[model samples]
Target: MPILQWLTRDEDTRAVRSVPYRLLQEESALSCGDPDAANMLIHGDNLDALKALLPFYAGRVKCIYIDPPYNTRSAFEHYDDNLEHSKWLAMMWPRLELLRDLLAEDGSIWVSIDDNEVHYLKVIMDEVFGRKNFTSTIVWQKRIGPDSRAILGAAHDYIVVYSKNLEAFKATANKIPLREDQIAEFQNPDNDPRGPWTSSSNFSAQGFRKNQMYKIVTPGGAEYYPPEGRCWVTIESEYFRLLKEGRMWFGRDGRGMPRKKTYLKEREGQATWSWWSNSEVGHTQESKKEIIALFGASNTFDTPKPERLIQRILHIATNPGELVLDSFLGSGTTAAVAHKMGRHYIGIEMGDHAVTHCAPRLQKVIEGEQGGISKSVNWQGGGGFRFYRLGPPVFDEDGHVREDIRFPTLAAHVWFSETNAPWKGKGKSPFLGHHDGKGYALLYNGILGDRRPDGGNVLTRSTLQIIREAAAKKAPTFDGPLTIYGEQSRLGPTTLARENITFKQTPYDVRARR
Candidate 1:
């Protein structure tokens, strides 16, 4: 496979490892509506914020949508859209890696870009999320009208999509609801009792199969056979079965070519396609108008996506109560749409607009403001989101755990580092959890009521016995190798081996740094 290279390619690709995981410090004052809602809006650089989220949200997000700076070499009021070619690539590589880590195995990501860097973006995404995972590049008509002044009027943008696993995504992906025009295609010409039905004209397929070239006699006693280069869609027996069930259709004169009558009641919906017209989803002009209505004309966001566009994505990519994430949250269109659509979301933005624009807009959404897709989804609103800022790193410059780090925070990191999975255990016990035939335990910050070097924080015979009891109480069925994190182990190497225990020192084997 080919790779995109630049001056800082090596360093940029490895940049995610160097990013110290920081804490998400929630601002209770900035939160609104239901305090316990799972929605979150974070104010921080996306790279660091994504790293911070791994311990809690990795492999959990069902859908991710990001609209990064297009690097169009033009100035914008909100985003720094201008950047050197290599710099743009460098900026994106590590973030893509982090986003890949955050995605569930059956999940997918949608990225919005333009001609400025879309080709390069596709190459890197193929590298990060495997090429086989590449789904489609949807041509979204972002502009309703053409830019008449340009040599070639640009009216579209590309939405590059990729799934974590193609087969898994296909198994669970939703279909797009049929539009009015599409539904109009199904009509009851004969007033069949089944419902509105549509006819499939191509009864003969492009293949030469002797078994499928049988003759078919219409109700008018006119016979038909497969064309020169084709065969009937089904064998004679299946065709006779369908004809007996009244599933065959002919023209009003009863002497036209035979067709299949498919009833509307049997159709789930329409499958998604590559081209998305402005009339189907929405256009940029509609997006700007939405932002203007929410924030007013004077303070409208520069490049907000229309709520209906995000709504379309969420509808196909996720179900209700699934997790959605957007690191380049921009004007919070993804969050608002996900909220109204009943999917939990985490929106990260580095700019102050996170507090100013994103939060306020979501507040309106929670308040039942009937803007954007609120009426379309029948959003009466009542949910809420917590606001957070990037806090101190989990580890300081010296690679030591921060003083403010508590048991729950360190435990989450320890579990994630050990198993590469989210921590679902409560911090009340030293036993973290078990994964893949290994039991993990963490003794930190007085979780066992004693923090002394020789007490609960150390792996002594007594502490080992306590941990064993807790593990047995939790799992009960079987025994496994135990990997425990503590300050020190008083047991000898022979005893440790006999007990099937591997003890790692705290703050050293914690994996807070690369």
Candidate 2:
């Protein structure tokens, strides 16, 4: 079968190879360095780190919030930002696989994206995370009013929500602090058994079916009924109980149609809405002001979200100690917020700025240095993280290994490059070349000293002797091909084919680096 059966024929398929997806192999690597630590700062390729995180976090995380690249061609020039639709799909498929493995059965994943790839991402997510798990596409107003150009102002971004299991997932409570103005609404003039209270409409719009346009008479013979076509939210049985319990309110002298008393003391904030505009949360301008406040004019992160905004999200989505992840950890706002709230967090970034910007920012949060709500929260510094790079990409410019890699990275790169190569690169292997395992891998750093002074060169003779001796020590009768990696024609033609030896040159036309 064709390897790229999932893609259209026109779609350019980067050659795929098998990679041993990067996953953490060390048990100690999973522990919070600080006994008091609650968050993680992982500095490595997310694709690899996510894979490494699987064993420890699978079916364990409560919520995941990733600001993955929007595939905004303009936003990511450093990574191959301008992928054709199919190519971009190719890019995300595998990472989603690992992410799914890490999600708890009751977990939720919130992805942020714009129009460039929203629809496409939805389809792919359905396939990877299961359509049954889909929750809602919460719209966030990233910008305010109109730009007055092109069809839409492109002012909004979307937060795509998906659940590991629909029946099992529920958003956490969002407790908006009581405001001074709202506090005035409370009163207990009659001194009921319950504490403070507030009056609410006797009618409710839900399933009222206009039957609740009920009329009742006050002591003064004045009669009142709900407006036409409106009905009470509560049933008559419950309404009467409230009246008997003094939980119902009526005008001056025990008035006309009664209203229910919704005790302000008992109520939480308003229910969260799916569509959040800048007014509800914040605007881009607000985000800019925050950047200036935190790091000053000297530092400016491309997309900085307000701490309060993140607080709202954290409040709605998860509880303390639950794991939260941010793969596109731009300025580390998510991690910083999660940490301050005492939730376990993992943040991944591919930029150097993550170190200079995100690391320091998080360290500051840990120390509880800056004021604001963060300081008031009483967080103390503790947790630590080890930063790792992806070493080198699997494929080189020309179809050959860029260089030999350490054991773990080599295993992961080999697996993914073969399965779902996340990176777009010229065809080349990171190893010198492929060879039999169990013994020394057929490593031939091609004899660059081909033009030796002593009458030509003995590079092939030396290499052949090395391979035969290495294999002889392991398997006496094992005389296989000496698969060597080298520039074509570097060592001239060899007559080793008769000795069960093959020397295929690394292809020279591999994709070049940017």
Best by TM-score: 1
The regions of model 2 sitting more than 4 angstroms off are 1-17, 23-38, 75-80, 148-152, 171-193, 204-237, 293-298, 371-514
Cα error, residue 49 of model 1, in Å, equals 0.3
Cα lDDT tens digits, model 2, 1-514, are: 1122346523322222233233333224333345445456666777767755553455677778877666676654334456677767766776676677667777888887789988888887887678888888878888767778767678788888888887777644345555477788888876876888888755455444544556556545776655555667665676667667777667667754566787875787666668876766676777777667767877776666766667667767787878888877887788878877878887887777567767777767655645334654666655554344434443554434444433333333333333233222222222223233312222223332333422112235555565465456546765444444223323445464465444443323222211
**lDDT, each prediction:** 0.90, 0.60
Candidate 1 TM-score to native: 0.96
lDDT of 1 by residue, 228-300 (tens): 8999999999999998888889888788899999998888888989899999999999999998888889997
Candidate 1 yields a Cα-based lDDT of: 0.90
Quote each prediction's TM-score: 0.96, 0.65
Model 2 poorest ten-residue lDDT run: 422-431
Candidate 2 lDDT for residue 414: 34
Model 1 pairs whose backbones collide: none
